[model samples]
Target: MAAVPPALGSWGAGQEYDKQPAFQRLLTAADWRPAVKVAVAPTLVLLAAALIAAIPSDYQYEYRFQSAGFGERFGSAVSMALNALGAPFRLGYQSPLGHDRTDRLEIALRVLPMTVTVLWCLALWLGLRAGLRRRKAVVGQLTRGQAAAEALRTALVLAAVSGLLGLLGGTEWNPSGRAAKPDYFGDFGSGAQKSGQPLITAGSGWLEAVAWTAVLAGLLAFLVHGTDALRWAAWRSRAVRGWAVSALAAGQALAVTVGLSSVTAFVLVAATSESGAQTGISLAFLPNLGLNLLGFGSGATFRAHSGLSGSDGSRGDSSWGDRSSETDFSFFDLHDLTGDWRWAGLLALVSAALLGRVAFRRGLDAADRLRLAAVHAGALTLLMTVSGVLMTRTTSSSGWIGSARMEISQEESGGLAFVSVLVANAVWALAGALLVPPLLAAFRGRGAGAPQGAVPYAESPF
Candidate 1:
């Protein structure tokens, strides 16, 4: 080539462009690898946990169809995973009796299976740690802003993949393939038509996808920033340290007790059952069951409502009725199935006392102890509220037969019982903080010799 320009000379020499522009870098797979590496394993683990949890519940839908095949079960598992991640689905159905007489049921299942939730947290932590290590190896130390940007990028990747999975999993399930055809029911005579066959359709909305993205982003940000913030606060203030330690100890105590109870129950169920499905369900929902029991122990009551409503267009008649009942019960009640629920309360009280003693040993004075109790109470109450939100589930079924349309719905208690539980937990925490510490101090003082390395209340610096 004759006298090529500088740019053309480089091109003519067959030199590769080693550096890409920012926009072009976005399209490159190597640039995106770190984020994908951080997101993929955690996402897969979450899906697996969801699948394990879902497999046990396959029996519940047996009434809808004769048997569930692998594809149907897998779809259900993906749907459950999406729901656990806060995606909402709208369910629509049309009965064979009449096309115009359609019924729509939207179910909101906010419950996060404890097993899945725990596994997701663990996986995310591991993935983030590994990603951070790799980033440090490549680029040296990252500033807070850089770390946050990386987290955000990873979160976006995770959310996008999850949303895509939700779309793929939200496919409509039509049993027998007859429900998909609009005129299949038309061939049969009026009395010969199938009544129970419902053309069911389910879909997750755009809003749900957006909401899931925001939630995932927030969770990642918290993991990146909130833990450091909390540590700084604790280091700066004795009150914060006492409260943090006490709340953590109390939480651990309660968790251990409830976890043991759940494990015991699971063991019993597994020992007695042959198929092991129930045991799997128990393992999946261990956290939910524990929280429910904790709420019950704190005097929370669960209210259950079931209703049926119907209208007959030909007869020009409509009827609607619902019945509501409330009770203070826990998973432990299943052991005896009795009205006496006093054991739950007693267990709670004992846990409180143990946590209180643990808090006292952390060298908190009267004021700090009081603060510890208040903070612990508030923390526990907030946890209960969040668990309620997560554990809430609603399901409704409706169908049309001839000129009659009917709907049946059942809802479980979620946030409604918080008030009573709050009061109960506060009382128990206060009693534990105030009473047990003094008693422990007095008992220690009366000892023949002070316990080695024990800090006496009088000598303590609060």
Candidate 2:
């Protein structure tokens, strides 16, 4: 009797996952079951928003005209909930935030939806982690393609969830041709009073849904696994510290600057408005208002118009009240009316600089880091710009006596000043990656590659 050789299965313990075909390695069923986890955060956010929406119940009449029966009331609430769910599916810049029939929702759908999108990525990452644990792989080393392939499964699931939501909400079809129909894709803005609208307008939300899917999948691979992008990269331990610092610094700064400023403004508005109830009603619009602050920070701008009372000052036209007044606050200036927003702008600049420095110092050469920074900043800026463009909806009505004759209708974007913001961010990110590290390094009297911060990992408390 002697010791016997271990079974092949036991020998395969740590590396079994790697032996599988690429497709099987990635698109397996492991990640599918927990895909539903993606919805949890978003649902929670919507529920909280609903609670806020229902707090007083005094303004409940805004959504419901009479509400005699329970079923109708329930249906309307369900509709509103679905609207909350679907609202962020637009350009990802604007949230449903609530509205006063004409007013937008008070919540920023951007943060919640982005959280859900990250959760979607997390679902896949968790699956990979579980599988790696089985394989005894600690750092989860693998090709970028493998991680991307695994991510595709989760992305598909996310898309399916989005499609399901769209189907459930946008399926407003009418067989009776007697009434005015809202635009097929009109769930966000107005109701259709007519009939014969398309049976489905589900694609409206899918664009953003798909966009999130792509972003999440890529991030899951790059941030968690380091994927193929790690080929020329240094060891994770050596590099993770730098990467984590950059991310944490930027994130914390953004949270502090953007979050604090937005909340402060909201509180001030609530405190000062003439009526508390009226103020609460306007609270639904705070999401958009906060977004205004964000635009100031990021140097992006959108437009809004209001009714004018007096005649045109320049021409002194008799029908001066015929046109709505327009203004531009797209970028932050020293003399901005709101000082808080200007601070947000400064914070954003600092964050961008930190991002460039950290990302460049992580592992890659200056050129590669430059490319990475450009790609990261450029992609995000592009998304925001495009989303802003899509979100610029214009509505016009006659002046006092039914005349929009002051000027012709123009395709307006509410001032989504993406073009300028895009240029500004790209220049900042590019220059930061290319210039900041060297400048700082020279100041410290060390070469660029010298371990600079050696800070704790982003997820680490130490």
Candidate 1: tens digits of C-alpha lDDT, residues 187-222: 453332355555566555534754665576547644
Best by TM-score: 1
The most accurate candidate by lDDT is 1
Residue 200 of model 2 has an lDDT of 11
Question: TM-score for every candidate vs. truth?
Answer: 0.69, 0.51
Question: What C-alpha RMSD separates each model from the true structure?
Answer: 7.6, 12.3
Per-prediction count of colliding residue pairs? 0, 23
lDDT of 2 by residue, 344-395 (tens): 6654566466655565456445545555565545554543443332222222
**For candidate 2, what is the TM-score?**
0.51
Q: Give the TM-score of candidate 1.
A: 0.69
The residue ranges of model 1 lying beyond 4 angstroms of the native Cα positions read: 1-24, 27-35, 53-66, 88-93, 99-108, 132-151, 177-197, 202-213, 224-258, 264-275, 306-341, 386-416, 444-462
For each candidate, the alpha-carbon lDDT, in order, equals 0.58, 0.45
